[model samples]
Target: MCVSCAWGKPAKPHPLEFCENGAKATSWEVTNRRADRAFFAAHTLTELETWPDHDLEEQGRLTHPMRWDAETDKYVPVNWQDAFEEIGRELRAMPPEKVDFYTSGRASLETAYMYQLFARIFGSNHLPDSSNMCHESTSVALPESIGASIGTAILSDFQNCDCIFYLAQNVGTSSPRMLHDLQDAVSRGVKIVTFNPLHEPGLQHFVNPQMPGQMLTGKDTPISSEYYQVKNGGDIAALFGVCKALIEADDALKASGTSKVAGTDAIPDDPSDAGTVAFAAAMAAADKKHVLDHDFIRQHTAGFEEFAAAARKYDWAELERVSGLTRAQMQQAASTYANSNAVLMVYGMGLTQHVMGVQNVHMVVNLALLRGNIGKPGANICAVRGHSNVQGQRTVGITEKPGLVPLDKLATLYQFQPPEWIGHTTVETCKAILQGEARAFVSLGGNFLRAIPETVAMENAWRNLRLTVQIATKLNRSHVIHGEIAYVLPCLGRIEIDEQATGPQAVSVESSVAHFHGSRGRAKPASPELLSEPAIIAGMARATLTKGVVPWDRWVDDYSTIRDAIEQTYPETFKDFNKRMFHPGGIPRPLPARERKWVTRNGKANFITPDRLFPEFSLGAQSDDVLHLATLRSNDQFNTTIYGFSDRYRGVEGTRRVVFVNTADIARLGFSNGEAVDLVTAIDPETERRVSGFTIMAYDLPEGCCCAYYPEANPLFPLDHHDTKAKTPSYKLLPVRLVRSGVAPAH
Candidate 1:
């Protein structure tokens, strides 16, 4: 319901009206791709490891529990009891600190609750999930700034918002349904301002495929009212420019007091005028409104004076240089923000996957707070998430820090001391595994190895592990890249029935828009051999834990009891879990921020002052020869899963191996428009990484910035290149050099 960018409640009537992007691709998954007991017996792990991502997943749904057979070099089928027994024995032999439990966004709230409970009771708080890779910045920043990790806007907020500031999200490939929201907003005359290195086509124009007349007549609806190509990793400076312009306009409005004569925001009429003069003349034509919410600042906020003073200190020239946008452009964008009664600040991974990811979110929240946007009808921060249930997983206790969780309640419930030590995140998990500190890896579905950076080194480290266990629905690269004692345990998919002792059971999933949805599988199970994710975790917990404090068998039989347990752990959020959330359109999980109740340390919304004008490695620090490489998802991809080889929005048809660069950069670097080249990163000279033979395509991004599809380009960046506070990798602004295909490497 969440990740594919579909509405929390999907549209209907016409097939094209289904706003979920991955629906059609997901429907193609039938028995044809099923990897039965025989399929596992047929292919060796080595043979499967050689296959590409698209080809590998096409092998179909995994049918049974299979253990790595070193003697035969193939996966051999094993019974459930024996498999759990073996895994439990190995885990029991090692310290719990040496085991890492990672989860994907696909798991349900019930499953995630059970998974983390098991990890905590086992004397380790080492729980990390898909949130670490994507919105960890949001998870960390929002709470510190506004007292809630989740954003304040609901799905309906899009309908009410007067203006939308859409930043760095390529909705064409990532979430097509979000375009429907923008289109609906546009139909209502809402102003949409977009900022990104490459201005995607969907943000420019869209002819609805559902409306035959529009498609046949070639009548298109424009989405973005104004588009700005903000440089990669330059969002903070760009935001500063807009903030500077807005504060200056407010200062002028306060000084003038409705008398508009030579004010800071006003301009005189001039005949035969240039574009800047025309814009100024248009602004001078109307009476200006005070931009900042003075009353809201006085009553509900702290640190405004300090934040405003810092904004006033920034020079226009420096903002122009760092943000790659002129003062005029910044003022125009700021004018749009100030004029609108309500503005929704929207952002995506382009803002998060950076060294200043947390700061980037803080700035977005600060901008929203300046105009009193939080807790309003159509004004708030919207951190668009990537995977389906990723946010929900975090809501149910999948995290590296256990301090955020109610430790005393859990300890009393289980009658055991909970592990309070900070856990290893995705980046630390890899380092621990490489250093031989972590011996076991348990994942709740995800192509972890392929999706991470430093693919070669990670794969080698993965193979050296003592044990690796994957609870999944389908075959992927992780299944093939087996550890010494790897076990692939097949589980029920979200689309299949998960029957238990309490009749057909439904698992609750939290959507990105704060809705708690009950996802029930109508279809039959993929195979009789498949077990539910909660059942699998329960089985492992029963075999491993000697105290047997939890009723693992009963929890597996009745998932509703699991919900009750979750409510007990997180009473404020998950209270009345069974009664409130299991219906047609699920009830919204309460957002304290939406009510203007800041749960921060000082009990007021805090306006943070960023220490530096330019975040992370600034534009001037790197040479012109170096380019910022951003990894992205194609049209046919969902997260790390590739459905096909097509990205129709950008005109790619048969290949995924391509790099997008500025048209001038190709000439500046002595390369043709479509020439093949090797991407090399010499950031870490000792561990210089390279990916060879990628076709170069001239695109509309700024110079010194390049783009490439993910997974294929994952190896180009090192493991240590990440945001320190959030631990999110710098996938968006990796500095690299494009050399000719046959040239020698940098290091």
Candidate 2:
């Protein structure tokens, strides 16, 4: 997290220009062009559905509470009291299982805490959130592997690392702020190796604007020392290949008289040669030292024998076929890891958005474990979060599974018995709504309709809801796709001033690095009608839970009370919340794995063994015709918010409907560059899912892999295509065929 995600005082705030389209939206939101009660009344659901997502949002900030009028086929203004009372009545009319409480990642810690608390008090555990879509695999696998849900390394590890394994992260488009960290690390002689389907410019080099010299000279610093385009969903195989190579090299070295390979067959086997300048120079000339941290592995880890045997059993041919990379490339990566003092394996959605998402993370941890990299200063798994405060939301107990959190402490402190059973995930929520089991859908913030898969199917099922509530700052696709009786309550954005009963209040956000810092909005609210997220939640809680024991109003008045309660609930992690929150850099939660202390059932980091070497998609799609689609995001996009039609990084200038494929695949599939193609998935003959009119652009990707932008390509994803362990939607792994769109390409 950067300045926007923390408590900081800059002459000018970071959100103004650095946070993608945040600054531009902030400027337009304060203008008179916004959606009021009248705007809603004038528009019908059919009309709103026709509006582009950008235009729907450009209708500006939602200035009043609105409810859908079935008779008029429009949303009419409703006062906060009536809206809250109506929502409460509807909720009370049905069992807690009928409602789904969903939250976006951008909400503050206080708001998330109260939101989850309200759901539990209302006797519902169905709290599906954005994390369920993105990094839920990390949440599921990390604890099993290392006994922690967070990455082992913090921010400082980047600077101290000797090498970094960059996997599937397109830094330029997604998070440019991280480019500075990568730039700093690379400039210090740290070797960065990247593995991705697309050759992202951020992974290649970066021209830091913050550094005046580089900007003045228009020079870019080279980043990755080597790059490998591993096939989609083949990251586990790629990593396994490297691990096998490392193990074999070490075995051969110790088995023979070779102490250090040093790139020569006649090298000496002296033990004292490790530190000598001549020997060190000779070692530096080679790719690897052919050594392993056996002591660290034996003392602090478990299941090594089983894991290694599984990895070694897979021959080079199978690994090469699955990974779509040469054996030499994997060996080179292993050599870099072997020679490095500390290696950081950084991965993004490329690894997590798969059928084997949890196993993908497990393999990354296993790779680090092979060399005893975890719990060290500059080495470990770095599961980069897509959003800023997503981890924080989960940290404050926003989860469907009650066992994943400290619910016992919460029940003890709040004096309310929460549901113990696991609730619906995102996919389950969609299914429940389709089957008429889910009566209502409540979202704190985010464009849930546009972000989810099977847009058409969900749009049809959305109307089945008895009620839908959107607590948001602006209009979105979700707002327009209204339930039978819908309410849109405007809330203050992060940049807006949140004036509370006491005074202007601040809310703390926990960054991905586990650092907790307060965020106080300084800009004026887009409208005077706007309410803070805490205030809106408090209103919902007050109206719903009349006999509630918790003091919602008091907490809303001063958020420090919420923080105080949070500290009491999570005494170990959030101890002295208020005091440490506004402190200089913020307090960090103590992760057990950070100190080589695994909090697993066996009290040691376990090497997870997969029953198979490759993912189901890779195994099933053996031929080049059944191409695997890895959905991507445009450079001009932030989640579902499309800022512009241009994606300068990917070389697309004026359109979002385009697909990139390798020349070999384009030819093999009987398609050519600039050909309009319809990418369709045939799960069954009766059902056809197609994203039509996509122009084919030839790019460097694996033969069986093609790239298309997300949300647009979301329809091709099967609803059931998800990680079994985490239930995370496998956005990356999709088998689709290409057919001529029979439409002319836009010139």
Candidate 3:
């Protein structure tokens, strides 16, 4: 029986809630597992490193504070004061710019806010967060395209939508709660079109494990109205194809001298001709409507005209060729959307994890604006985030490159001159480490070593650090890979209540739709030894800083004071932050686009021309035999962490080492299903890096495209293979080749 079953009746009393993954999170936290000093004493760091990620975590959660002993090569137990003093000494001794402070979504708003405050007070803006890896493209592209980085729609909007166009995002595994919304929408006659490379179970049928009747009968709810297995990196082309088809249809109508279709009375009599004219008109309107603060853009942004010009040139054939989507299919998508009362375009890492990811987001926004889908009810762009509070972290100053406004606000709030120098992004931080420019790294949360791309290089860079501090809940690959002086500080998990010196603290979290709500943990702490992240950060700040720049103790003692600080700092949106959080659903920040008020200088949204018609990938002069490989997550996994070996949705069982390849490509490459091959990537002419050996599986994937699990295939990705604007790794694009060994090719 599962842990939930053991409790007779589950404690969760909320209606319209709970999925398998949610249950897993709850159970994992409530489990009778503990990893303390004795466990570390029993096992050496080398021995622990040899264990599988799951086994090590399953051993029990880390329950005590640990400090790395260089000679012993193991994390030994240390008191809280000792750990803080040591870390404080190292951090205070180093130059502020030489230290990199990183944050993960797992950190609470109180913790995240304190972390940023500490870093700013220390006079360094070196805060590189997990957002850089995931949705930086959304952050980079959406604001320029629609005058906002977040979606204009709320969860309730899905209920009234006529159509939902889901691109690249897997609803079931990524955000299971979205499945409930999708199901409800489908039941209400909403058309859902899913475009992905693999046929995900969430897009097919999802059986609510929590529904007793459904669980007992093994019944499943139908999901997608239409599923399109689009080729990888083909979303932009697919979008353009849809737009072109709409344009062509409009052109044909105009040529025939038909104002409207005989059967369709919905279209206006003077409906403008489609094709280039309609696209151009839409682009023009958006540009006139959306403009960034011109001063900020001129001062902060580079390459504006180049991007605008690229948007002006749109060719259907070229788009079709690039996207691998049929013009007819595109037309269908566009027509369906245009005819629909309301449409929502939802996406995830699939669209953003590419070389042209930023451009891809721009295209998606262009489509939304063409039909005036944004800022209205039941219509918007939904970037289904991977983690719960990832979006919130960014909103509260977790960025490395915080604009002048945020920095200035901090200075006024604390009476200290914050650093004006631009901080390092994730990729830059790695480069800094490799170049020995950065001396120390402090991670609020997250398995940095495993989550980052080019794991081998990242590990080496991590080792070069003088001091590394990880505030985490459990033991992961990151804890094992240590700097010269390392500390593993166990922090309170989300499931555990964070009672500070004052009272039970509630931290704010930003949901996917940009709604901010307070998340108060209901469960007891895993251990009394575990300290809240905010408390730990405050303790470090108190011990490290020579001068008290801000009232760190007040904020740490009571989280409400932190809210007060955030409200004062970002008064524009976070007004009455403390009072509003008490609302049942919480309040949403004022998105200027929601009211069609673009924050741009012209007070209008702008159309940015793409730099290139199509993204180009050259993995060291690709050989004829080489194939481009894309790294992806299995259904059973979330980001870099794997829950199990089986990928139930993809039909892979008991394995994480298998690679999916198109049958035609496998045949052409003289390979067969189950054939083991060495996957080599051309990082450079002199260095041919081997990613990993995998047994090939002939899957119904697009020809010229292949995919394998991430981190495992991360070795194939060079450090430099990333989006130019977002600095996100091109995990969806890689140039590689297969080499057969020992056995003959399948007959």
Candidate 4:
């Protein structure tokens, strides 16, 4: 419901509050097709493996619990008791450290909480999740910059913000509902500036579906005030350019004696505020009077001296060159930001899916800090999330790495000794499995095979596992690639009724804004055999642990018991969980940055300046034909879930195998608009990681930059290519070159 879910909490929700994609997602889940025992009996493993991703899932909900029969090469129905028993036996046989537990954003808060608790109690910390593949950089960077990993602003901030810098974020395609907010902002005179390698149509113009006047008139709302097609892997440089512009503007104002604190003589002789006076004096004495929030920085932040010094080193020419934009364009964007009273910056995977993803976010924080935009009304950083409850999943402990609260706290709360060792992330897990260092893998939900980069490598590695289990609502590519003895356990969809032992139950999910709301299914169960994720988890825990303090039966039947335990475990944040969860709107978790409170190591927000400002853009001593490739999602898709083959918004019809290339690049490479080419990895000559027969279409993109849909182009990326700090794969930035299918080389 976009209307009810909008920033301002309306007293009454609008009758029509959902979006087109929302309807599609619901229909996709509530499909009539059923994957019953007959379905499995009719299809063999080899036959099903060749089906398209959507086609396999369209076969419908998995009706019965099944186990892989290696000899017969088909999945046979198994009772829930036998499935749980065998899984538990295998889990207990292996060293807990050798097994990894994975989760998806689709799981509810209760499921994620119980799943993590089960993993820790079973003596393994290897809890990798879908967050590691997307938005992990947001989690890693924001915590180091601010006190928390989550964004600082609520959705209401959009109403009052004067200007918004949309960096590498396409609100129209990824999250279409967000377009309403952008439209409202535009209508209210809010200036929106966009920076990306492609000029996204959603950011350019959008027609509101709920508004009839414009729909009939065929007029659309203009979204972006200015759009800059920044080169791929140039976000750091573009952000640096903005910071540099502001610094130089302040320097110019100081030289002209037009700044508020231009000289020491202008300062009042208020002895009580000597620090402010001294700051002015120091600025007057320095080569450039740094026009920063001196009082706020001195009182609430650390490392400004180092950050400012590093920022001053980059001049306009260097930044412009690196960012692939002219000096005037950067200056205009900076001027808009500097002139605005309050500015909100929203960014997406375009800025994050890079080798330097962490640094890119740090630069965004640096830009926000330059004008003191954080911790104020209508001013903050908004890292747009991909899925519902991704943030909640992390909050409830679905992390491969945990440092906020110690294991002792969890141990004391749950009355068990939790594992102390760090777990493997999605990238590390792939490597560990490939090297035979890890044996078992259990996934709560997610299409692991398609969601991860280096698809071939991940699939090849996962095939060597002793056991692999998937708890899902629909069949995905992960179900096809399995271990020697694999298991497919069907689970209830989010939109299906869940009749627990206590009563009809409801699960909660957290939105991108950090508000937790109850989501109860309205539709009937797709199949009678489907089990709730929490119930399945409880069954597994009971079968595995000979004895434990936690009551699994009670927790599964009555979800309120799970909430009570959650409240006790996260007392400070989840205080009175049951009372607040049932409120008109669910409770919001504590955000330290919102109140200008820094809970970081030094009790202050840190202005981190990396040793280097830019990441390596070269293909590492490879052929010169390499171009930067950015993997994108179709308009009709959400993450790895494809609703239809047509991307109506992009005018891409009936195909997802097209490569978008800049017109200049196409001509320079002696290729036409509709030429067929083979996309190959430029980094490793030894490996033939090629996607053949991809049609190249001319697009509005920067030179040396191309675009294609992900999972299809994932083969071009090496498994190890990821952010050093975040361990998120560099899906958006890959070194690639196109080889003509039938013609000779142009160079």
The list of candidate 2 runs beyond 4 A from truth reads 1-32, 259-290, 617-624, 682-686, 742-747
Question: TM-score, each model?
Answer: 0.94, 0.93, 0.89, 0.93
Q: Report the Cα RMSD per candidate.
A: 3.4, 4.7, 6.4, 5.1
What is the C-alpha lDDT profile of model 4 across 74-183, one tens digit per residue? 88999999999999999999999899999877788899999998898898889999888888888889989987787887777888799999998777777777787788
lDDT string, candidate 2, 454-474, tens digits? 788988999889899999877
What lDDT score goes with residue 34 in model 3? 85
Better of 1 and 4 by TM-score: 1
Clashing pairs in 2: none
Clashing pairs in 1: 3-388, 33-60
Off by over 4 Å in 1: 1-7, 10-17, 28-31, 257-285, 615-622, 745-747
**Which of the numbered candidates is closest to the native, going by highest lDDT?**
1
Ranking by lDDT: 1, 2, 4, 3
Candidates sorted on TM-score, descending? 1, 4, 2, 3
Candidate 3 lDDT, 1-747, residue by residue in tens: 111110111123238567566676566666688888888888878788788777766766778899887677778889999989998899989999999999877676667888888898887799998888888899888877767877676776786678998988777777676776777788898998888887778888878766788889998878887777777878777776665455444433433443332221122223353443453344344432211123433433334344333332456567766666665566567656656757888888888888888988987776665556766688777887776678778888888876824877777777778777889888898888889999999998877877777777778778888999989877888888888998999988777788888888888777777677777778889888998888899989888877536787788789999999888888887889988885665577788777776776555566565556566645444355656677777766666556778877788898788788989898888878899887777544445567556889988777777888887787777777789989988888776778775432121
Cα error, residue 289 of model 2, in Å, equals 7.8
What local distance difference test score does each model get?
A: 0.82, 0.80, 0.73, 0.80
Instruction: Give candidate 3 regions above 4 Å deviation.
Output: 1-16, 210-219, 259-317, 619-624, 741-747
Per-residue lDDT tens digits of candidate 1, residues 1-747?
Answer: 433542455323236555435674456344456887788788888888888988878878888999989998888899999999999999899899999999988889999989998898887788878788888988889988999997777877888899999988887777777777888899999999998888798889988877789989999899999998888888888898788766666654444453332223332122222433343334445654456777787778888777777777787788887778888888899888878888998889998988788888888887887889888888887888877788888888898898888889888888888889999888899889778788899999899997777788988888888999999877899989977899999998777788988889888887778888877787788789889999999999988877537878898889889999999888888778898776655768888899899999999999987777554543244466788888988878888888889888888889999999998989988889989999988577676589998999998888778999998999987888888899898888788888888786543
Best candidate, TM-score: 1
